[model samples]
Target chain A: MAKISVYRFLSAGCNGCDVEILECLVPRYKLADLGIEVVERPEEANVLILTGGVNVKGKEELLKTYETINPPKIVIAVGNCALTKEIFDKGYPMVGPPDQIIPVNYYVPGCPPRPQAIVKAVADILGVKIEEKEDYWLAPEGFRGKHEFDREKCMGCGTCAQVCTADAIDVIDGPDKRIVRVNYGHCSFCAVCQDECPTQAIRLTREYHLVTNNRQTTMVSNEVDLLSCSVCGGTFIPEKQIDWALKRITTEKVPAYSEFSNEILSAMKICMVCRRSIKNIREAKRLLTRLSEKVRGF
Target chain B: MPETVYIGPYRPQLVEPERFELLVEGNIIIDARLELGYMHRGIEKLFTTRTYAQNIALAERICGICSGIHTLCYAQTVERLMGIDVPERAKYLRCIYMELERLHSHYLWFGILAHSLHEHEAFLKIMGERERVQDLLEYLTGNRMNYLINTIGGVRRDITPEKAEKIRRTLKELKPLSDYIMSLLDDNGAFTKKTKGVGVLPRERALDVGAVGPTLRGSGIASDIRKEDPYAAYDKLDFQVIVERDGDVRAKALVRARETYESMKIIEQALDNLPPGDIVAKPGEPKVGEEVGRTEAPRGELVYYIRSNGTNIPERVKVRTPSYANNFAILEMLKGERLENARAVIESIDPCFACTDRVTIVDAKTGRRRIIALR
Candidate 1:
């Protein structure tokens, strides 16, 4: 029987992949139980398991290892970085895929592929198809293709807007009429916003349908009505989101009503333009007061 | 004449040196010269191009075992730059995940240490038990690995009452198993024989070399990032930093073993006092300045140096990983040790190759310089 040797390679990638690779080879998954052994040098290796994404500095060494390894050597590209350069491939100095940099026979995908998956990939490369029933215990329901926001369901309370990754969700129109718009392209479907939604308005449906024939249409936006003021009939948005804007527009400039009068407020159900006009009038009054005080001091 | 032992992927060849050297005598290795730069990846240079938000995910991929620590440090650094204050609840969550990561990382190291010592049964047993912790992490965070839980300002997810209950139940199951494992650490004679005094990294050497985490703790230098520089909710949690007096492989193992118990205690306390509030805090972009964020990773202290130019993208993102620093002490640890003890010694430091790949090696004898390979 030929002695089977394993060469675990990491290419300027995260150390977690290497640790997981070690996990696969160790007694937990026991790659050696099937007569596999980890060799220190690439020359003594029969199966080369390449972990991590190829960084600029590590590319030369990676190419050298691929060239040095003997023929009939099976290469397994493990983890998302190695398979597709996943997160790091955007603008990072990635050489290419593990197969592009070297001759790869098998590919396992995961942020860091589980030890079982890695072990399975190795076994498959060795021409030994180890059949194990797929465990469906932890699998989420549906063919969810990442996460997509139902713009209609979003309250635009800036809850999802606050936690969005793609900077996809933004609360425009100040806080009162704040709307959420998602850049679908930037969304990885991690569904963090959906999970953190206060009103349970943003939900990640199992529907994995996302299409982008044009860049302009990739962003999906939804507007929501803000909680209006009982007295002024104006949008009294969440205090938290509008604190920055409010700091610029002082309380004197903000339209106020005398004695919380709903009758006077009902007559002034005006849009933002009219509301700004009313606010300016209030500001002019405060400026007059300040000027009078200055004149008296003089 | 000393012969160079060439162990290549193609074939093994032994060639005599051009000069008659007294360094090598037959099979006995008088001096060993390591050849690195077989794998290199320019990850640091790449960070400059990525946005600060994007870099959090990117940094997490630097090392799988300590991905949580990497993301935590990155997030904390960005938060500091942005002048955002994380909620009390988020801090506790961060501590919980950090301790859980420490548990799994130490368990992983234990398995590796046992494997290197050829204690196959113990290795399998330790790893098989580690799956429980992984399950807990998976249950809390969506993914088992690369958990995108940490974000700028605060965490992305929150553990609810139901989830906390589940965690409590799981901890109950893990407690006895962990206690049993701790008992076995001292009782197992074979385990002691392989680790005891095999690799002795002195306390002063550990401090001078700037070793962090369990490696420094094992050397009796009580320098823990959690204790010294409290980040997340570590300051709130009640747990001791485990330290051992002897700077041997056994002491390192003992540090990790005791830390596992401490980690469990931290998780319990965090879950018990879990606060109810928003998990994330919304804040503006960071100002132009340099800020440092550090966390105690499973291996040691993982530090991230971030410089923001008042833009979404950072000007520079420099990571000083625990493994990267700890790996520097390897040559010193291996100086007087035999070739057979190399694997055990490496495992003792909980060497993280993913973290160590950033190191640039310069030859002392010659002016030749080489970068450590990732593979």
Candidate 2:
């Protein structure tokens, strides 16, 4: 078998992916040991490895480099930016994902995919088997890897979506269900979502090998049941969210609030709009004002 | 007769997309012009669109090598705008991370410089040592490149006793290897001979051009943002600002090589006197005002100026990266340099084109820049 020559083309990114690609050459990963050479020019290369999102300038470079590479060339897009444009997609200068610019054979996903993951991609490209070492698949402790969403634990408060730096998490409030979709293709894996999660539903698990040929393989979505307004029959909030709130109310020994917890819970069944119109109801209004006072105290 | 040579829009030596046009007569370069904007993603404009929390990630992405410093500077700036006091422990943690980043960045620069000089053995050895530092960073803050430990008010992560122990142990192991590498620079080997008198940036000229970090220090300037401004735990910690007198490629290498020791020293001090408290403060809203945040990134002084509209998002954000300042002085250094030494000289300053080409409105009258699209 001939030695594999890889040509790295840097696009418009933070250069995190490039650093990881270079990191593969370190003695630990031994990209060189695997009979791979990082050639200086595209014309001298068999595989073209591109890192970063495609901006106008990067797109030009990408197309020019792709054309320069000789026949039987392989193009591997490394990092989230290359696959889905990640956080930089909204930037003014960004051209969409690199795939829209060039034909990518393999997509290595991560904010910047782990060095080992990149090594795996190159090995897979050449149809060479990787020599597994001890702790080969283990990411470091506290490693921010793939995101895990727990449906049972999720209350659909949208805190993960709100605090997401990559804008990777999207919350869709449907009639019967609140769908929270996490696109790993756009995720930076900074774990701000994990940090700000109120119910600890979102976590980055220790599974670093996120490389895929299909873009849809990177998306994980969870759906939560939404409770409808009793009067208006409109979906207001996730049913589990209300249950979590009620559980919190019951656990905390707010004597005044605990005594009238039933009344408050019953009033909470109607949506905010319906509750506004029903504010004139004597019993409900009295309970609401009392509940509001107790809420501030708690 | 003068000849023309183009280095890149794509070159292995250039990690980012950049081009160098050199006009040469025989072996010496008569004129050199650098072409940029290939790596620009309009990060400053993007900052305005994202909220303060999201902007932290944006700031980190400006330059991957010196990523932590950007977040630290941006976080400090927003904290000042909101008048939030970060916890003492968080400050120490921030200091620790900054120093570790400096070590990693310097090691990377050293490896690249070694590789460029055809010192493949040294490059591999240095990179191996760098991976250890990166491992320590990964253990401390999850990821290797963009740590993302910094938040608006304080740091998001804390260094436990085990992580602190690992940092100390790793630095202890690295000290001897780094010393050997520094000694190699001290030697009369091919590496030292090739770099000794090449790409000299005079102290006076460096000062005039407002060069920062190792690029300025290598020219014998004793100034460092950590010492002068005293941000984070630097005011509390003790470490000398390493300076070299030569102002050549070798001097710049020496400055960075020696500074790794100073960085290790600072980290040790911060760790030994680690304060006990919460790692973050309750963040407050930013006031409608303008403020600046500055810090010593691995490459040089990084400044982030911002204006708030009294909202979650900033009205405007302007970044003055170290590479942006250091880039101007390169042409001065390149004027009389040998054509072969051109790449070495440019790499000496560790110019981060990604940091330099954020946004530049060249069209004056219309103030509308054309966006090029591929067919």
Candidate 3:
């Protein structure tokens, strides 16, 4: 293999991704052993490794650097910021994911991709084998990587979306179904979603190799059925959430709550607005009677 | 004729994007002016839009190398605003992580210095040691750079007994390597010759320029936030504040290198006296008020001023990173030095342009700004 020179451009986002790229040059990774050199100029380089997302000024600078590189050049966007702009996308000055401005050939995703992942990105593009130490940069036991969703365990309660550090999880409440989508591009791999999930429906699996050519395909989504209110006919809660709430009630030691479990389950079906509209005890009694009678038909 | 030389908006010497304009008469630099804000990402304005929990992640990204300290400072400030008392175990855990971060950061500085000095062998040795420190951090916190262990009321992670033991073993192994590196630095003629009398900042000028961290301490000032304010478990730990009187590039290097031992000692004490109990407190709702959280970051004093509006989100968050102060001192240090030593003096202060360049600077006389807004 000929000597491949790489020029790294540090853009506007945090410097975490650049630090990880430097890690590849350390003794363990031995980027020098692969006949790859980190050149000072883009003109001398065959590969351009860009870290961080570009801001307004950086976007202009990035384009100039891109034009300096010769043809037959490969551009690798490393880290979540470079791939999807991550948390900085909400900021005013940010104007990138790098691919929007220039044509990116490959994407290595992580808050900051591991050193081996970056080396793997370059090696994969050239179709070269990474010899020895197959488990060198393997994800550890508690490593936060790609988001994994369990459809059976999920109830679409949106707690993961609420606690997400990067606001990467989106809960779309449809008339019949609630769709919870986890966008890996915007994720920082903080695992706050997994920690706050009420049903343990989300997990950050130990699969850190998330590099891909397509940005749109880097998402995992789960859907659950939504139940409408009996009184107003408005979609309110997921059916699985109602079942989970009933299971919580049944596991309690109080016999009084369990004795009225049917009535409680029927009342849970009504949306808060309709239930609050009952002005008196007579109206509440009439609604409960009608709800119980309706519940029995099922 | 005095010529103007522009060093960068992009250069190999600087890690982040920053430019230096130098007025030089032949080989000597007469004056130096720094132009920054090229890497601004609007982090302070972004803080207002996110929830408190999300802000923790944002704070960590302010600077990647000293990430743990940023979160520690932010978390402590939020805790104060909410009037939450962190657990004893969490306090001690924070100290352990903070010192480990210092060791990692200082080693990284050494590696950069060595690389610029053309001591490739020393650079590799220091970076190898740094990698070990990062490996320990990764094993403990799951990430090498941005540990992400801090939360509003306490730490998100805990140090187990097995992990504590591993920390002790790693520090022990690192001691010999550090001593060998110190000897290499002391004996090498080329290393000492280039660094001995270069980039000299007198003690009075260092204080005048408002230098912080090792830059201030290297000039014989014993100012350290950990000693004066004592946030986290620093109050209970035993460690010395290393000081050097020379006020040169070598002085700052020596201060950082010697302080690594003090960091190791502090971590050992925190591990030995690790408290037993919960690692977190239930954070309460924010009461409307303003509070400041300050800590001794690896580079120097880091301050985060937070204003809460009786909600989950903060009304305002202002971060005063140590580099912001130390960067100004470079202008003073750069004066009257040879043009060749300019990069060394700048790197000596451990400038983090990403942390410093949060806003655009406009000259009062001309009323002009470098960055123009589009749309």
Candidate 4:
């Protein structure tokens, strides 16, 4: 039987990761049953579980801890903040992520990854076989995980970015076209994007094991073409949005829109600025025709 | 032989960073001083970059155990600044989550303190029971530790009858475990003797040191922010403040246990009286102004001050956690106690010091800089 001892050093991140670690030790998970013990001194520890993003003051202590442990020591970064610093990586007092200061052997990521994830990370390091994580616990029905966009369905109106609760989504509408960029590191897993998407293009999947030493691999960028305004030369609505508008105007069951002809259907493709001017000109012609008929009758 | 022993910068086996200097004479302590910092992440500074809608996620991360209340308290502060009217149904849902948080936090503290006293079985038992609450929270909010259920005007999620039934069932099942633990704490001589009169803070000293929540109530104050300045659906819930007069470690434990009972009661009443309506009231941009918001968290009275500069993002956000005020009170409680009794007495107050370590201190007597923490 292998005997292992660990020293828990939590730095600046939220206490969520710490709680999950404790949960693993409790009756349900029974992490202790795997021949692991928590030791008080660094010299006796074979593994160091670092559960937080290193803050300014924790920097010196962390370095000392890394040094105090005898060689052949393994360091594990336990949560999303410890892995990438997430959204709280900016501004004063934050030193950096754990790996930036000390070398890390493994990382388990989540806002607070379920206790199972921690167990898996530890077991892999110990070369012990453990069952895979229970997906339901890690992500309940609505728990946000990975951001996925269907390039075929996405019109790239930038509405997903506009409605995003976090600045995780960015929409760039230039002279050319539009694209929505998804920075997974900054995402809070709120899924406001899924709710606000008109084309049902964006989705948050239940693949919650997002731990990565490098964050660049998790990002997503989807591009789409934009339509030119019928009246002006500037790029207007997304091409897909024009089709959506045409379908809506033609398919309405209401009596007011039942008589819609090809003229009205094509007019829906025009930008709002041109649509308004055309409506004014048509009304002026109708008024002139009415006045001429009245004079001819006199 | 008065010697000052320094503890931490990187405390062993603790959940966060904290430093404490104890003045000891042999096996007895003569004086005590605490230095917080060591975990400050400048979260308050990070708030300026996020809009009011996204700030709840940051506020929820303030502390792991008291995650729900931080977001609830910040949401209140932002609501006050924006003058948003919360829906009636949202108020009751908020109350349910708040009480649930208190229940889980007390259980966590009880388990950790049990471990500190070297009673490993009791520690495992209490922590095991805490999972019931965690699972319930997960079912309701889709996350376990930080619920992140609150938005500026109201809550992000609503409770259905089925989920409410589950919570009620869990509470019913937990009542017996809570009772068993409380009874054990009251009768078990092995546990009580070490905790009973080891660190006695007089009622005056407790108030003078600015202790709040169960700590102050343990010293016979009977003061609670829920009753004093009611927020959410607390005004509707019929509950009493749990207090005791002994002012010792055991008294603090008893008060928290009783508060757990009261929290259970509050949750039941709130759910029973839950009104039907919208869960959130979408807030508009906040005007340039500052407002302080208050809530009774699991530990004590939590306060949040928010300043908005006529934009979606706030100009500043400051948090004053209950652990900060109660932390100073432990120093007075530790004066003249046995050196061995230090850990139990400090743990008894549920000193979640990591959440309140914002202020920087340069101690003249010890000539050492103390940085508490920002939970």
Candidate 5:
């Protein structure tokens, strides 16, 4: 059996992760029972456990420590910091994401991963396959993928942008050509944007699948426009929704409302006939009811 | 001869000049000199750039254990600056969260202190019971650590009657457990031996150094931010601030243990007298002005000074964390104590390294300056 040693490195990071790591070492989830030993020196350890992201001054020391450790050493980037650089990434002089600095063998993702997950990751890395059921309590709520906007449904209302605490949503194209753009990196999937959208245009898709070689592009979602009403010529419907239905049909690109001349506007559009018909039908129904009551009284 | 000692969260902690040259012929620490800053994150500098609303979130992230306290202070300071009134119900709800934070934080510190002192069984017992408070926090606020309930004017969530009932029942169940733990403090001779005479910070010295929370209360000073400043609905609720005259490790422990009981009682009272109304009031951004906000965190008084220049972003924000003040007394407490007792002496103050590491260190011998490291 190969001797495995783990050296946990934490620099200017929250102590909660370190405390939980200590708890894992205790009698309850004893890692020693599984041939894992925590060592004081990184050079002697077979596995390096990277905890906190590297802050300004700690960056050099972290790299130096990684260099001193022998080759064929497996690095396990633990927590959100080591994997994606959650909060600390925004801080000045940040040197986070172990993969950016060094090659990582495996990654355990979480604000602070549970002890069980850490244990499982370690077991899997050591060439042992262990199947475990997902814990629903640990799963994140709301959308984990890119944001989608239904353009046709959007009333050019900036409610989504206003309600977004993260400021990820932006109304880029002006009031006339209103287009909502979302920076997926800043979006926390809080669904505040979706809830605040007046027209029910913005929504979180159920797709959680994300993968990328570039960190910048990996987390962001691509934007798709909704389809508009052909008669009124309003791009109020999401482009995807219309495309899904009218993919087989031939449709010509209609001119924008501003582009239509007075002659073309009057000839091309039929204004509110359905709305007027509904109102007249309701009025006629009321008259007939009143007439029936008068005859009965006579 | 000046030896180097490493501090801060880094592995093989950064080595700093140690001016303390102890000539311990027997079992006494003859001399000690204070060394400062390896953990400074420039939080004050960073705050200058953040907006008033964004600053609230940033302030809360200062310390995970006392995140709620920081947010409360920040929100209050902004409200004061804007001259806006927080809803009556909001104040009561804030107090509930604040007290719950105190219960969990003190329990966490107790467990850590016990663990440092090598009382493994006691540490586990304390932490096991502490989870109930965390459970309450998770139930009340969505998250266990970062409870993002605070907004610019008031809180975001309201405590419904059904939720209040659940909180009351949990508090009732935990009351007996806290009492059982407190009983152990009286009979355990080992606990007394390790803490009673250790880390003695005299009342005058504590006051002179501007110690707050249990650190100050342990020194026989009846000073508490909740009592003195009376932010939120703390004034409405009837509760006594626990104090002890010993000014030692044991005194601090006793103050914390007693405060836990007082907190539970306050929670029970607040639950019964909870008012029915809106949890939050809509308010605009704060105009240009500076306002100081203070709140009693689990450790001590947390003060935030916010300055707005009539812009979306704040001109400057200065945070005086309780740990920053309480940590200054460490030099006085560690005097004439053994090296092994250093951890206990430090933990007794409930020093928040994240909060305290802001101070810059200047070398006495060379006048060279550097940040103090905290490990």
Candidate 6:
């Protein structure tokens, strides 16, 4: 009677976190021995477990549920959606982060954190002994590694960043250089970068030891010097990228490519915008010549 | 005269956000009106901004329960468009994960079904078995939920001989538990009393309203994408397309329970006949074209339509999820049933709203300006 109770709500989420949360209550895990119970009624719950990000509609409902729960309540935000609001972040449905609606006291982050993470969260909130799962039973061994960077080989074309679906790879523009930063924390270890890397520069070595909280500490970055456009003198692609492209294009010989002059080679060094502008000017000149020919006929 | 009861977009017992206004006379529901768009995340619109590889992660997030199949369908669709052939070994790897995912998902649904019926012991037992499945999956693929296994060309991870042996051992351990669970479902008079003849959607109505996966299979329709289209080395595996005659909650339960056994068998076959070769075939940049990918999700048949326009990013990505078809069929199943049966009927179809509602009818504003997944 009058024990600690939990009321779990999913704002607008994928069922992953919610299912994992449900997994903790299984007979194997048995969260009830800790004197915490998942109550159906919000009024009875002291721990409100939010499994999703708060959207516009969820903001109102979350607040309503938050208010209904009694005082001295602990709001534990489970999953990345609740902590970071990444599910529909900046989408039309999202109003703000979970903290904006109701203050979150604790956070358990993952696409969906393992069930132990959730149990630990519940226990931590309840002030109980947090039992961590044995590493062998939980995290699998084999082929688990963080992304590695080869500074000499990276052309800084941002292909890794572009190909990254996890949004782990970031192409940071510096005043003098371009940086390809790979965040190990967010990396899905899908190896798409290795597959998509044009230069075979970024690779995955079997090393899973580095785990850190600081974003900088976990970041594996490579920087390259920027190249100025031949036409506009604007900061174009990286110098390494230009060199790499030149080599790749030249090596894959087209019979017509053997006739390249210095002027043509220099024209190839123009930035994409300048290249487009040059093509437009050539079109305009042809149009003017066609008009003059019409005038001559007249 | 029928009275009206607006069930929820908000309620204590409800799992997801869905508003159902029911017209009931003496707790017997006559008609139902569904109100959607609580949080349509606009995932399809976001797809155009990301590269092919990036969308795999995005697709996995579509729904937690069947996240594997989303990647499977989307990858297959893009692969189809690009004319890239998946290696035989990779196909087997893909099948292994898909089956494991199916087992995990069905276990999840079964536990929820038990909970909905207030069978707490049964729920706990089923969830325990589910945890073991999750552990095995985690062993095979690094993460538990979104394995991130499938790629546009082939799969990312390969199952080694040691891993295969462990998987076989796990399956052996799981079989008895599966048998025990099937017996419990078949024998439990209390659960049967509540579920029998409850929320019956006949064969005609199931097909008429476009029910797919286990919901259709529960109604004795043996329509499975794995057998029909045979994606991901499923053609090599010999397993029955589990179907039940009754179109009620019990039939749905039987279909899912038996389907779990079939999944375990497929995994067994896949692991035994595990091939050797490259997991992925690297293809050139996708040309301008459109293609469709269909696969059987834990709930039903999932379809992904992808269009490319010569660039790395897709031109348009439309996901027609199994839940999209199965969710609508619930409306047909809900009519003239008691108010209490709504939860059972809805859960029977396993409504994956995140996958279902991809259309954004309008737009609004968020207070934050920072983009989430954009790099």
Report fnat for all candidates as fractions from 0 to 1.
0.30, 0.76, 0.55, 0.67, 0.04, 0.52
lDDT of 2: 0.83
Task: Quote each prediction's TM-score.
Answer: 0.69, 0.93, 0.92, 0.86, 0.74, 0.80
Candidate 1 lDDT over residue span B1-375, tens digit each: 333322121111110001111122333324434333223345577677666766676677666677888889989888989999999999999988888888888777777666667677887777777777876776677656677778888887688788888877877877775665566557466677677777788988988878888888989988888889998888888889888988888888888888878888999899898888888898677798999988888888888898878888788888887866876666567556644554466667876541221123334456354443322
Residue-by-residue lDDT tens digits, candidate 6, B1-375: 456555556543535777666666765777877887665666788788777867888888888889999999999998888889989999999998988898888877877777777778888888887777888887677667877888888887777788888888888888876786677668565567778898898999888998999899989899999999898898889999998999998889888889888998899888888888999898657879888889989888888999899898999999988877877777788888876677777778877642111111111132222211100
Candidate 2 lDDT over residue span B1-87, tens digit each: 666556566644336777766666766777877888778898888999999989999899888888899999999999999999999
Please provide, for model 3 over A1-298, each residue's C-alpha lDDT reduced to its tens digit, 9 standing for 90 to 100: 4678888887786787877786677877767867888876667887888878888877777898888887677889898888888888888888888999999988898888888778877777778777746454776677777888898999999999998888788999988999999998889788888889988999988777778888888899999999999887899999999988877865554433565677678778888788777453456687567545554753
> What is every candidate's alpha-carbon RMSD to the true fold?
10.0, 5.4, 5.5, 5.8, 9.8, 9.5
Off by over 4 Å in 3: A132-135, A231-234, A253-255, A272-298, B12-14, B187-190, B354-375
Of models 3 and 6, which has the larger TM-score?
Answer: 3
Candidate 6 ranges with C-alpha deviation above 4 Å: A1-3, A122-128, A131-138, A142-159, A173-298, B12-15, B187-190, B353-375
lDDT of each: 0.64, 0.83, 0.82, 0.77, 0.64, 0.74
Which parts of model 1 have CA positions greater than 4 angstroms off? A1-7, A24-48, A55-74, A90-93, A116-137, A140-298, B1-40, B180-184, B354-375
Question: How would you class the docking of model 2?
Answer: medium
lDDT digits (tens) for residues B1-375 of candidate 5: 332232233333111111222223233444445533333345576676656665664566567567788889989988988888988888888888888888888887877777667777887777666766765665676545556678777887778887798888888877876776577566475567788888899999998988898999999999988888898888899999899999989899889989999998888888888887888887776777888888888888888887888888788888888877876787678777765565577778876542211223344457565553222
Over A90-125, each residue of candidate 4 has an lDDT whose tens digit, in order, gives: 747778788889998777767687776677667766
Weakest 10 consecutive residues of candidate 6 chain A by summed lDDT: A207-216
Highest-scoring model, lDDT: 2
Candidate 4 lDDT, B72-118, residue by residue in tens: 99989888888899999999999999889899999988887777777
Best DockQ among the predictions, by candidate number: 2
Top candidate by TM-score: 2
The DockQ-based CAPRI class assigned to model 3 is medium
* Whole-model lDDT, model 5: 0.64
Considering TM-score, which of the candidate structures 5 and 6 is the better prediction for this target?
6
